[model samples]
Target: MILRAFLFLIVVWTLPAMGPWQDCEGAKACDLDGRSYHIRVPDDWDGDTALPVLLHFHGWGRQGDLIVKHQRISGHTRRRGVLLIAPNGRGRTWDFWDQGSADVPFAAAVIEDVAKRFPIDRDQIFVSGYSYGAAMAWRFACENGDGVTGLLAVSGTLRQTERCPQAPKHIRHVHGFADTVMDFPMGAGGDVTHPVALWRKALGCAAGRRLPEWQVVSFLSFERWHWDNCEGGHTVTLDLHSGGHFIPHGWIGWQLDQLMGRVPLYP
Candidate 1:
């Protein structure tokens, strides 16, 4: 069931505070740099506890609203009690590759604004994206590692640049070996090796160790390469899947399980 990809934007302000949590269910407006980003919060939140937040970016020409509808993200956010912030790109595309893109500053502001309005765990902030959005995710995680707890990039890789962030962080990149749109090994869609090498070098890892087990979910199977014993709890992982350009079913849960240290279900 391939869902149509559409991207959106929203801007929001603080809402009326309830007993313990603010009622932030459904779509709301979030203002950053005079632009509005549409954000979704779960209604079932207890309001008293600080929850992790995920900033999800859509692929090029896709809207934030469409990502929630198509990416199976809303269900994940609801069940995980995660605050989701999906911001639209200026022209349905993010300028993250450009060193001077305003999207970076806007993203930083959005995080701050969300924290001010909700009970968000600052230390557990996450960023994720697909395709072009995936590139943006890498850019953000690379440049602002200190502010991000982890990042997940699908079907894309980081843009070549002068330098990478010195801060240690966790990173996961998932790519389909059969992808044709982004072209798995070449083309604009980044291959797994370069990004992994980039981070390994930055983290001073002489080599990456291979995981003992391969993970599988339905028709999707992946093997992992991990950089170990890096400074500052920094971990770099690359999961190469035997699939295509589209996001596979259960992909979100699979990555989340990895993040939470839960084993992926194998068949």
Candidate 2:
């Protein structure tokens, strides 16, 4: 009952903040659907206090090396020592919109398995994915947001949310305005990642209006405007002038920083 009340208070806090540091490169096993994942830890772990984690999920592709390499998440982990986890979904698609309660348990399993080795900061855990993977992350946030600090989903749309959980006080999202697969204004035309505007409304941050758009001309055009604070603090949409249905290479670290509550990035 105490745990329940604590979580209740957490949800009611309105505007809140802040998880652990762990060795993602260590010998570990992540079990899902009777399948166990053999993983490797990074070589540069300095054994610091528990750190924040970035749960990176690949879209429909079988392997995610290209997205992982181009996006350059290791750079952020190298500087901040944040634990980065990459999980492969069963079959070609995630069980996101089942409406039958499948992805929630699978998500919990993944986190639990990761925690067995690394000291995972529950409040600081984050989720990110591409295409179908992004769709799953958004769905996860709606259905089982209790497991994450925030979400950084790229190029996807929203679907089947009656089973989706509430948006926590500590949350954020992103999408390309021109995304053909998951159009920007949301609904009908796009991937159903949720209308970016409406998605931002759910965060209800008090700090956003306090800060204005201070960043300069960013390479990811769409990322520039939406991510930059407009009238309100929430920035779940992007204009993506010339961009397409891919995660722009330049913006991965910045999004990760947002997940860590504006921690300064290292050079």
Candidate 3:
């Protein structure tokens, strides 16, 4: 009995510790500029093809691992065979308010590292965010247009761009009409309409066309707008939901569809 107990204790002592730093199976933990991030590869991946990668930013007061563990975005990513990466922000919030912020370089570094370590499709790189992260996504999309193929923004508006981007990008902005947190017609950092207008102008859209209304769910109505005559085949879509102050259940799926060129008239 003493011999058996000794062996068991030895085995337990040699086992690796399960901690917050440990990533789940098929996921990796990465650090850049003293910040940490979590990268998850779809379990269903064929292990041969170069898959698209999505960099999803968390809202204020949230960490990358929390988002990876709790957010429904991962489900859509897995179904679509896309690699999902969640980055931690400085001080539990993104630093988009600063020019040439550390977050920018950290974002670039994460992409660089992920591309080097995984089978990333450079052309299909996407960035998405919620709330404060959403604002940061817009900023990155505007400034790093060459690196990111598209942007998925929710529950936040962006600051004005300093200059026009060299390439036009596809952007989908979704928000609730009754949101009190970020509030419709956004109070601080500019209203919701500003970024849409900037994107239209930056994309060189000659005109804006409103699409027909589609009711997504009970008590949830939607209105969409498309920018016409954008350069580089780029387009922008705005989805206004009747629900408020929360990420809609279907929004992530809709975003994946849009990125895959499977956008439906009603989503």
Candidate 4:
């Protein structure tokens, strides 16, 4: 199955080859500021299925391809039934919130545009990212989680929770304990807020125990933490033990599949 999927991506990449989506047989694009996002077309895409959608944001110096490449490519219209979108940043690094209101608007534009063009299910819309990209996800979640089911925030810190909106929504955070760039103990002090603690407080799960459930990828120890009893809803943390800023292979696919529930596995 892995070989087939790998070959499938290989075939996709071989076509019209530009960025990773050069051969994305089911992709579309929008060029702005010289940046292009190669969107994938689900094998089962009917243009009216009201399926779910995922907005994938990349970290600093990264783009949509980084997220798409890691996604479980499906010839079907959706993955696990959800339509996934990997939006490239005009600046190669997204500013979903921060001071770059322009980027945020651009992101919002992409979300709306895709939903309009595809049969995206409104209730299951989701956003996810890594490192700086995670920071951007938090920004969006803080501002838009009301519309989204939840956020798959990974390997980065949040901005000052104090400056964030008054009420937060369902949030799933995945952080690495040994991340030197964004350490667990530094809570925004390391340029990114210590996400887990703040999220726990916000979710009203500030007292949950730290459960270690994870895996090792490329010799790096990684794990996830959980904090139940959230205020608005439920929340989980994919805490990486010795993980770094990069997203591991297995978890990425799992996340995409898990959230895109009912979406057929990428064929």
TM-score of each: 0.81, 0.67, 0.81, 0.71
Which ten-residue region of model 1 has the weakest summed lDDT? 6-15
Q: What global local distance difference test value does model 1 have?
A: 0.69
| Candidate 3 Cα outliers beyond 4 Å, as residue runs | 1-28, 160-168, 186-195, 215-219, 263-267
What's each prediction's clash count? 18, 23, 0, 25
Residue-by-residue lDDT tens digits, candidate 2, 1-267: 999999988876632211122222323444456754333333355444565777766678543333334325555554555666666677756766555447656765777877766666777777777788777777777767655666777776464234344553344444555578755545566533344544554543222222233332355444233333333332443323355677655355666666566754432
Rank all candidate structures by their lDDT, best first, as comma-separated numbers: 3, 1, 4, 2
56-92: candidate 4 lDDT, tens digit per residue: 7777886676555554232222445566677777668
Regions of candidate 4 where Cα sits further than 4 Å from its true position: 1-28, 31-36, 71-79, 96-100, 166-169, 183-193, 216-222, 236-238, 256-267
lDDT of each: 0.69, 0.55, 0.72, 0.59
Candidate 2's TM-score: 0.67
lDDT score for residue 85 of model 2: 68
Give the range of the ten consecutive residues with the poorest summed lDDT in model 4: 16-25
Best by lDDT: 3
Q: After superposition, how far is residue 266 of candidate 4 from its true place, in Å?
A: 11
Q: In model 4, how large is the Cα lDDT of residue 157?
A: 56
